[model samples]
Target: MSITWYIHRLRAMGPAEIAHRFVEKGKKLAARGRMEGWSRYRTSGPLPVLPGLADNLASAPDRVKQDIVAAGRDVLSGRYSALGADWPLRDPSKPFPPTIWRLDPVTGGLWPGSEAYCFDISYRHERTLGDIKYVWEYNRLQFLQPLAADAALTGNPDAIEAIEAAIDSWYEVNPPFRGICWNSGIELGLRAISLLIVTSLCGSRLSDATVEKIRTILHAHQVWMARYPSRFSSANNHLVAEVAGEFLISLAMPELPLSGRLQAKGRRILTEEANKQILADGVGAEQSPTYGAFTAEFLLLCCFAARAAGQPLAKGIKERLALFSTFIAWLSDAKGRTPGICDDDEGRVITLSRHEPAYAASVSAAIAGYLGTPAKGPRPPEIELRDALLQAPAGGPAPPTGLRTFAEGGYTAVRETRNGRDLHIVVDHAPLGYLSIAAHGHADALSVIVTVDGKPLFVDPGTYLYHSGGEWRDWFRSTRAHNTLTLAGVDQSTMSGAFNWSHKAVASLDGIEDGENWRLVASHDGYRNRFGCLHRRTVASTLHGFSIHDALTGNPDQTTEIVFQLSPACEVEINGQEIRIRSEKRWLATLSFSHPGQIESAAGGPAGTGGWYSPRFGIKLPAPRIVWKGALPPEGLLTNVHLVPE
Candidate 1:
């Protein structure tokens, strides 16, 4: 066979050396033991069905199988084929296509799409794979294989021939099988593998050459799986597939030379990757709640497959999946929406639910199967409390927490601290997964969103997407979008560049104590990205309402204007006696007053573009960047009252 030629050509490593690599890795895993709840014993072949396997749900028996069949036909027949359009690239042949990789229209810098597409897709898709791992592929294989086998068992020569021809056509054209350095090609190869398995099962005639080709492809896949040094050995969702694919294919073809020890290496790599990548907080390193759920689902599939194949189901594997399943469930709200902190696929990636309720049900099913816990009703606080249990070892400074409002990693959490009487502060800072903050970051770094009662007099204008229009992008990242001091003439960072390096309005709420009226002192570097320095302070008045104090330093002569505009969801009222603002969504009302300190301007600043800034979901807006500007007085303070229900 030509397999030796390919394997030796890539690296002259002998089979012994490759096998040794796996053995060494196994020893390292053994050293870690079960302290981290990782099991060293690995599995091969179809996973052993657990004790309650009969109770396991199979996504409603593929009730939409006909729809899937129709869709499959459409895809195969090139009907409704917007393949290139759906992707930013025109062709898969090109590396880093210009659509996602080009000079920014504004900054003259390299576009962010290249990094965005790779990171976002890999991270998010892997999350989906987490929950559905190989199930989609395997289930589809199971269906197609049996159907093909039946056709062959009967005298349906035409059906068998047609399936064989399709498999051959796919294999002939697939880029990886042909010599191409494409990631999508790897995915396409997976598709081809599924096709071949189905065709072979259907009593199709196969030449000796075809069987050899299958062996070559499987070997190629294994080589691809092990190419990346650290990757093949890690314990993340990616490793699960990378290793699981080879293990499954090898098991299917008993003639392959893969030894039990060799297969154990791949499984070891899977476990190791999972341990390091999944956080004790039950959050994936990638940090999107949607992806978190994705990861859990796929891993469950892996465990199921392992157990069914008679391999040992690693210790704590099910618990980890259950934990993350719960985390995603907890992050979801009544609306079944998470903070879009990252590129959430709306559940379409893994063919899961799109909205919250469906996702809640899916999670419940997974949890019930794995944890035997009830899947419905309000989530227990233990979900949040258990976050502490996921913390990395001692002396590793605790992962960011005590946040009042932080949305990153496709999940947003808003907190209202009542540690002190009538004191309130909100913080927002979460890890950024695959989402772009190029337009949504605010100038109010460490800026606190304050309220007196149930009114939101001062706030950060919740951003909606970048493509809504240019005005939306510009305005959403402008000083006006946040509750902070703005110089009348000076602008925040130019809205021409991606938001990765750009400043975001965030706060540190680790050491806040409730005393008088709620008081939070936070800082943001958004303005500093342009002007050398500028600082603003917002204080909730212990007496009447809330006031924002402006402290300006750089560009002293720079005309400054301080406008306290209410957020879109806020109800605003301005009067001589008091200003009241209220919001039902946030369930808080606030009054805001700002003093134009050492700053003066007659004409309000230029209007910035405004709108939502997500690629996955659709958003609508009325006008472009909205603005309100006025004169500023030296050392001034503006006050607003927030009314919160007593």
Candidate 2:
């Protein structure tokens, strides 16, 4: 870690956090000695299997069971896949790769596993881990779910043997409190969930010796999470995942001595953290729709586990879950595609489907099932299977319809049907981010995303890279990268570090007028302190189309540039002052500006400076970006977009 990082941490974190880390480091040092002979340690007794495990397994839809079994057989046959790649495990009879292993997917650099934590390994800088994402994928043990499924379905002895051998190999290679895999509580939490799923499904087939080893490893994970929970500003989604993992382990495996304590602690933390990280508007505190979906899924899993254990969720928790589901459902476009705003790591708590980059429809369907409501759209097979597993009662109330505004979240959605076509538009004028770090927040203040007939026309460029600490990271998060106005070529929010924002732009909704046409007005003071200017945006949505007026107050001499990023699928042609946007040779909309300005189209080039879109983490594609630059007029500027559906 650099001195700058430490300074930022000190400034962002409080004295209590510093003290907590001090103590946590000591505990880790002491635990290192105890972890040496962890494999030889004997459990006090046989672990207690979860109550109603068999019933819950049996409750899964027959189709889901068959799919799980099929996935497991595929894994055994060395045809498994993860992170958009084919990943095959070696034969069980062969020794596993050494535990002290570090390979950079991006740069293909390998290092001893022991050095994973000892040295300051910048996964981004060294290009050693490519994204450090694959490491987490490998450690999450999600691949094991299929194995457990196969073992339970066919009573396949080879499947059971494979699961046992894999678990043992991981344990032997990765000692507790060591290596990159042990560095994250979120990873540990995911592993715990995977372990529980496997054990709950195939525990009957495992030998006593194998069960003991699994229990021992689980205990270590529980202790680690309990000792070093993601606290303070760090307590975001990672905290939720960690506590949920501990809670699930405690609920599913009553065999450990600390299971009761873990259960209570986990429950308390999960409940409190859910309320803390999830806003009252049902949006995640992180302010990213993708992260919000991921968090909601995690909470849903907790609710599922709680229900199975005969523990009902708190009334407030259930309501919050419903709100979360509603928010995502409403934000999703007609095609069930959500805007890739803020930091999207493409993280999932579980893989129930083969759909790449979990679809909004599938997530909404699963949520609808859990909440006992009719799905708003067509349900995919994965969602159907999950709905069955969730045991949702058929036929219930539907979610509220029409234009809704989450004032606290600073999100407004206007949905209308014209000419038998659905038009949905979302306006964001929320705070820059959640906590001090705002780790996942983007600098796209006053940005808007619009979908006509369920297709994205105007879009958010999306986060392309984090932790790479390069121009690309900065460019992706800069003001110019978003569909917003930039003053003097400055970002709306100051980027202090890779994940930290300083001098944040404070934005608020000025007012909203609803009628046959809806109007939303909002402004941000990000430039007020620096350039003595404030950017005010007005969006009016009519049946025919929409108009966006941007005005800057205070500074008239400064340069102003307005950007409108188009979806990668959109093809645009500029004729005089009118810009026509089309997709697949079909005209979607036309944009016109009131004042003459320099217009330019941008795409990624060899210089690495241009327009680009990242559909998922670590993947970028060329996209069209329209820029309008001119002197900041005393009266500001206006741009009108008319949707001309044909």
Q: Ten residues in a row with the worst lDDT in model 2?
A: 392-401
Q: Which stretches of candidate 2 lie over 4 Å from their true place?
A: 29-35, 44-57, 77-96, 99-101, 114-125, 156-158, 353-355, 359-361, 376-388, 392-401, 418-421, 606-608
Determine the C-alpha RMSD for candidate 2 after optimal superposition of all C-alphas: 3.0
Pairing residues by index, what is the TM-score of model 2? 0.91
Estimate, for each residue in 1-646, the C-alpha lDDT of model 1 and write its tens digit.
2353333322423465567666754754453332211111122222211222222221213322333333333222312111011222223232122322222222223322322222123211122112221222221222233234334334345444434444453334332312121132224234333434443343235444444444555554554444433232123344454455555554444444553544677467556545544555555554544545555544554465466557755666665665555444444433233333332333211221112323432443444444445542233221110011111111111112233222222222232334222333343333322222222233434334443332333444444333322454445545555545566544443333322322233333332334344454434444565565545454444453344455554545555545444434554444533444455554454444454223211112334423222323223232212223444445644544444554
Give me the overall lDDT of model 1: 0.38
User: lDDT (CA) for every model shown?
Assistant: 0.38, 0.72
Give me the candidate number with maximum TM-score: 2
Tens digits of per-residue lDDT for model 2, 471-516 = 7777778888888999888888988777787668889999899876
- What RMSD, rounded to one decimal, does every model reach? 13.9, 3.0
Model 1: CA > 4 A from native:
1-169, 175-181, 184-219, 229-262, 345-349, 352-368, 376-427, 431-508, 512-608, 615-646
> Using alpha carbons, what is the TM-score of model 1?
0.50
